[model samples]
Target: MSCLLEVTALCKTYRKQHGLFRQETIKALENISFQLHAGKTLAIVGETGSGKSTLAKVLVGIEQPDQGEIRLAGKVVTMTNYRKYNHVIRYLFQDAERALNPSQKIGDMLTDVLRFSTVLDNLQRQQKVLESLQQVGLMDEHIDFYPHMFSAGQQQRIALARALILDPKLLILDEALTVLDPTLRAQIVNLLLELQQQKGLAYLLISKNLRLVRHISDHCIVMQHGQVVESGPTEQLLTQPQHAHTRKLMGMS
Candidate 1:
């Protein structure tokens, strides 16, 4: 597979306020580097405040890093050119409800997404929308329902459909599976795997669920306090974690 996304010495920092007037800088990510290949899933595992979400935000152009560079498909990823990358990249937020509109019908929401698309005609757009919904296990009848009317898992499926509707080459899922029940999480994981196989899509999955990550990821990055303590092929890293932090994270002595 080709390298779809590359990060070189990526860094991010935030302002830390110690008191009313005192402030310091907190490093969110330090020298973080990785390459995400097409048609594979890379899982990022870390405790709270370890910068996994920050990395996802940076990749999706939601936040700018303090230093280093990111290249997507050989093009520099910048705020100015981020819109141009939308066709090839999509982000599935952890809060699917917040990501969706409450007032709009599902069909209309899908239709609105086409306002940014250049490939589909009216009929083609509707068909593509239906196809995307179907891919997520929703029926055509779901098209007329509002987001507030669906279950959490179904809402998440809608969000996934929205991301897939654009036929993105790279997807950043920031704790997307965290809110689901075990059965639903497993179902969605299977759906994502199938999609990856059929579409050759690359995924950057952020999660604290080691069990889920172990099942889904090709590679894993173990982070602690904004630093990557260990990273390797998922099986190797999970089975033979070398870092004390990684071993602790995996609950292995």
Candidate 2:
């Protein structure tokens, strides 16, 4: 598989207020670097505020990095040129319900993404929407329903559908599986694996779920205090972790 995404020394910081007049700078992501290949999964595991979410936001253009660059499909991308890459990188968040507008029909939500896509006509866009929905185990009838009309799993499936509509090369699964129950999570996991096989998607899975990480990731990276503590093949890292932080994550220390 080819390298689908690359990050080099990415850094981000925030000026957070400590009190009414005092302020402090927080290093959200520090010198982060990694590469992701097509049809692969990289798991990012850490406690809260580990910069996993910050990294995702940077990759998707929601936040700008303090330094470093991002490359997609071998092309340099920044905030200005990021829109060209939007169809290539999609983000599925933990809160599937909030990803949609309650008043909008599922069909409208799916089609709205095409407003930015110039290649597809009305008919092609509609077909693309239906095909994307089907890929996630949804149906045509779903397009007519509201966000409140589906179960959590089904709502997540719609979220996946929305992300897949543009046939992205990479997906930032930022705790996308956290909200579902065990059975539903397992089902979504299976669906994700199937989609990978079918579409050759590269996944950046950010989650605290060790079980899910072991099941779905080919590689794992442990993070703490905005820096990577350990990284290796998932099986090796999970079984014979090096860093104390990693061991702590695995409940070994």
Best by TM-score: 2
Best by lDDT: 2
lDDT digits (tens) for residues 125-189 of candidate 1: 88998998999999999999999999999999999999988889999999998999999888889
lDDT of every predicted structure (CA atoms) = 0.90, 0.91
Off by over 4 Å in 1: 18-20, 117-119
TM-score: model 1 vs. ground truth:
0.95
In the order shown, the candidates' Cα RMSDs to the true structure are 1.4, 1.0
In order of listing, the candidates' clash counts read 0, 0
Worst 10 residues of 2 by lDDT: 112-121
Clashing pairs for predicted structure model 1, backbone only? none
lDDT of 2 by residue, 51-170 (tens): 899999999999999999898989999899878899899999999999888999999888988767647889998898899898999888898999999999999999999998888999
Please estimate how well model 1 matches the true structure, expressed as its whole-model Cα lDDT: 0.90
